[model samples]
Target: MADEEVWKAIDDLHAWLDANKAVDGPEALLLRVLKLSEEVGEVAQAVIGATGQNPRKGTSHTWDDVRSELCDVVITALVALRTLTPDAREVFATHLAGVTERSLDGRTP
Candidate 1:
C-alpha cells in the first residue's frame, strides 16, 4: 500500500475508535502506546517459532507468519502515533527521511 493510503486507513480506524469511545484520554493513550510492545512481542514469538529456536516448540510458525506479525507491529505503532498526534504521516516521513539520509549517506544503498 502507498504511504497515504496507510495513513488514511489509520485515520479511519482512529475515527471509528473515537466514535466508539475506545480512546478517551491519558489512560487510553498509555494503553495505545503499550500496544506496540505487545505487537512487538508477537513478532519476536513468530520469529522464534519460524527459526525453531525453541526446541520444545519447533517449527511452530512459518516465515510468512513472522512477516504478518511484523506488519501488525507497524500498524499498531502507526495507530499509536496517530493517537498521539494528527500529523503522524508527516512526522513519520520526516523521521524516515532523516534516517534514510544518514544510513545511505545521500547515495542509493
Candidate 2:
C-alpha cells in the first residue's frame, strides 16, 4: 500500500483504539511513545532469532520475520506520531526530508 493509505489506516485504527478505551489523553500519549520501545525490542528479538544468536534456540525466525518486526516498529511509531498530531504525514515527511538531507550530504535517501 501507499504511504497515504497506510497513514489513513493507522488513523482509523487510532480512532477505533480511542473508542474502545485503549488509549487517551496525556498518559495515553506517553504510553504510545513507550510502546515504540516494546516494538523495538521485538525487532531485536526477531533479528536474534533469525541470526540464531542464541545457542539454545537456533534459526527460529527467518529474515522475513525480522522485516515484519521492523514493520511493526514503524507502525507503532506512526501511531504514536498520530497521537501527538493530526498532521503526522506532513510532519514525518518534513522531518524525513531534513534527516535525509543532513545525513546524506544533501542527497535524497
Candidate 3:
C-alpha cells in the first residue's frame, strides 16, 4: 500500500474511534497511546507461542499470528501518534529518514 493510503486508513480509524469513544480530550489520547503497550504485549505473546517457548502452550501460534500481531502494533502506534498530532505522516517520515540515515549511513547524533 502507498504511504498516502496508510495515513488515510489511520485517519479513518482515528475518526471512527473518536466518534465511538465515551471519553475525549487528553484522556482519550492517553488511552490511545496506552493501547500500543497492549498490542506490543500481544506481539510478544505470539512470538513466544510461535517459538514454543511456553511449555504449557507448545506452539499454539504460527508465524503468521506473530506477523498479524506486529501489524497491530504498528497500527496502534500510528493511531496513537495521530491522536497526538495531525501531522503524523510528516512526523513519521522525518523520523524514519533520520533513523535510516543513522543506521545505514553510520551517522551519529
Q: Candidate 2 residues 20-67, lDDT tens each?
A: 766467888788789899999989999999999988999899999999
Q: Among these predicted structures, which one has the highest TM-score?
A: 3
lDDT tens readout by residue for model 3, 1-109: 9978999999999999989998878898889889998999999999999999999889989999999999999999999899889999999999998888978896655
> Which 10-residue window of candidate 1 scores lowest in summed lDDT?
15-24
Q: Write the per-residue lDDT of candidate 1 for residues 1-109, one digit (tens) a residue.
A: 8877888999998777667766568888898789889999999999999999999999999999999999998888888889889999989999999999999999877
Q: How many clashes (backbone N, Cα, C below 3 Å) per candidate?
A: 0, 0, 0
Would you list the clashing residue pairs of candidate 3?
none
| Deviation (Å) of 96 in candidate 2 | 0.6
Give the whole-model CA lDDT for all candidates, comma-separated: 0.89, 0.87, 0.92
Better of 1 and 2 by TM-score: 2
> On a 0 to 100 scale, what is the lDDT of residue 52 in model 3?
98
Ranking by TM-score: 3, 2, 1
1 against 3, candidate with superior lDDT: 3
Model 2: lDDT to the true structure = 0.87
Per lDDT, what order, best first? 3, 1, 2
